[model samples]
Target: MKYQPIDSQLFIKNRKNFASKMKSNSLAVFNSNDIYPISADSTMPFQQHRDIFYLSGVDQEESVLVIFPDCPKANHREILFLKETNDHIAVWEGEKLTKEAALKTSGIKTVYWLKDMEKIMFELMTQCDTVYINTNEHYRANVETETREDRFTKWLKERYPAHQVAKSNPILQRLRSVKDPIEIDLMQKACNITEKGIRRLLNFIKPGIWEYEIEAELMHEFLRNRSKGFAYTPIVASGNNANVLHYIQNNQQCQAGELILLDVGAEYANYSSDLTRTIPVSGKYSERQKAVYNAVNRVKNEATKMLVPGTLWADYHVEVGKLMTSELLGLGLLDKADVQNENPDWPAYKKYFMHGTSHHIGLDTHDYGILTEPMQANMVFTVEPGIYIPDEGFGIRLEDDVVIQENGEPFNLMGSIPIEADEIEDIMNS
Candidate 1:
């Protein structure tokens, strides 16, 4: 891994919290993600399943974490089954985590090789009445391909048909939503790296530069700062291309007097930081562009304040919609008749700003948080609001990641990065 090692204490606390939530006499299992194949003898990089990474700090493939808090034997309470490292594997790949190293990395004392999983699991399953299986329950998830966890779940249920099945997604969705202090620190590091990348673009972006070139500059800054790369597919939409919400082609050449929307972020140690800044390709926004940019920034700031504890996710969006509507009226995009005759399902503001103002941000960019539940402290969210005007041939979006506090306004992680119209202009010219 390119990033620094995190203390295992965070993982220890995470496991304890998760175990406490499991049903009595239930054992929860987590599996690592598979190295996906691209073609003949070709494969994509292995990304550890975010759930397993959250519970145990294990960042390797063919690893399993079993938490049986009510196990008869104390040593069997927590066990990790890892791919056995041999001389051949060491020479071919690299050093896999040894028992001692796993202990240091995950705080799990009992470590077994992957081959012993059946025997060990059989012994443990005989004593437990219920088994917790992991599954994807994210609000935006629409997975078609079966994952490693899904395969293991099918096998587990067939092998132990008598055992009561429970879902680990419920517990993880709540726990991971409210981050620990250590997790917040890691996210801050990711955001700081994103700041460096965005600041670098201030000097590099100019007329006639290809959008992909800006992407390369950000990637270079991220790699040097110890980040693996972008948290998501970067959107370097320039000119009217920004009107497309999910535009990620990054193939257009930026022209002078046009606004380029950069929806980019840096991922440090698998923790994600989402940021979006629409800047002028000429290094200075024209009057109309500046007006729209400031309006979006204002909406982002107001939306962030609504992320405090006890706030409902759906209600928060409604409040943000109102703010955006007022801004749109002030910008002359909507009128009294538009507001009065607007559809309740899709308001007049949807014409310019259609997407939600914020989303949970942590391990995944659009991370796991139950929207129906009330907001809580330490939950990180990205406040992004945009105004797209196809007729004007430009679009503007501004975003910042914030952490909801216990008793005050949410803390802005990207506060150091320039967002003000004048400040961005000054930095670009400097």
Candidate 2:
């Protein structure tokens, strides 16, 4: 990992909290993600399963974490199973964590090699009456590929058919939604890295520059700052491409008067920061562009204030839709009559500003949060509002990661990054 070692206390507390919520005589298991293959002899980069990392801080493949607070044997209560490390393996690949290193990485003292997993698990299964299985239940999830966690769940269920099965996703959704002080600091680090990437582009972006070139600049900054790179597939859409909400084909040339909607962010450790900023290709927004940009910024600012404790995620979007509708009406994109006659399912603002204004942001770009529940303090979210005008030949989006506060307004994690229309223009021109 490029990032520095995190204090093990965070993982320790996470495990304790999760264990407290588990049913008595139940054992919860979390598995590391698979190193997916791209083709023969090549593979996509390994990404540790966020659940395992959240509880154990084990950021490697072929690892397992088990939490059993009610175990008769104290040492077996919390355990880690890791791939055995050897000198030959270390010479071919990088050093895998030794038992001692695993203990330091995670706070769990009992570490076993993968070879002994079956034997240990068999003993554990006999002792525990219930098994908590981890599953992907995120609101935005549309997973088709069976994950390593899914395989483990299948195997465990087949092996221990009599054991009462319980889901760990619900508990995790609630627990991971609220941030720990340590986690908040880690996410802030990610946002800081993203800030560096954006500041670098302020001077680098110009007419005739390819969208991919801008993506490269951000990647360079993120790597130098100890970030693994983008938290999600980056969108460096220039001009009309911005109208496509998920645009990632960064091959277009940025024209002199067009706006580039940069939906990009950097990841530090395993935490994610999501940011979207629209900048002028020629280093200055035209009068019309400036008006649309400021309107989006105004919507983002107003939407962020609604992220305080007790706000429901669905209700918050409805309120944000109202703010966007007002902005669109002022921009002449929507008329008062359009809103009155608009379908309730598809608001009038949908014509210009479609996507949701905010989403939970941390570990995963679209992090885990139950939308039906009320917002809580320490929950991190992205306040992004965009205006896409295909007729006008440009799109504008402004986003920032914020922490829901106990008091008045949520704290902006990307507060240091320039967002104002004048500030962006000044930095680019200077």
Models 1 onward score TM values of: 0.99, 0.99
TM-score result, candidate 2: 0.99
The 10-residue segment of model 2 with minimum total lDDT is 353-362
- Indicate the residue-level lDDT of 395 in model 1: 90
Candidate 1: which stretches are off by over 4 Å? none
The root-mean-square deviation over C-alpha atoms between each candidate and the true structure, in angstroms, is 0.7, 0.8
User: Tens-digit lDDT track for model 2 on 1-430?
Assistant: 9999999999999999999999999999999999999998999999999999999999999999999999999999999999999999999999999999999999889999988999999999999999999988887789999999999999998999999999999999999989999999999999999999999999999999999999999999999999989999999999999998998889999999989999999999999999999999999999999999999999898888889999998898999999999999898889989999999999989988888888888888889989999999999999999999998888888999999999989999999999998999999999
lDDT digits (tens) for residues 1-430 of candidate 1: 8999999999999999999999999999999999999999999988889999998999999999999999999999999999999889999999999999999999999999999999999999999999999999897999998999999999998888999999999999999999999999999999999999999999999999999999999999999999999999999999999999999999989999999999999999899999999998888989888888889888888888888999998998989999999999999999989999999999999999989888999999999999999999999999999999999999998999999999989999999998999998999999
Model 1 lDDT, residue 306, Cα: 85
Model 1 vs. true fold: TM:
0.99
Between which residue pairs do clashes occur in model 2?
Answer: none
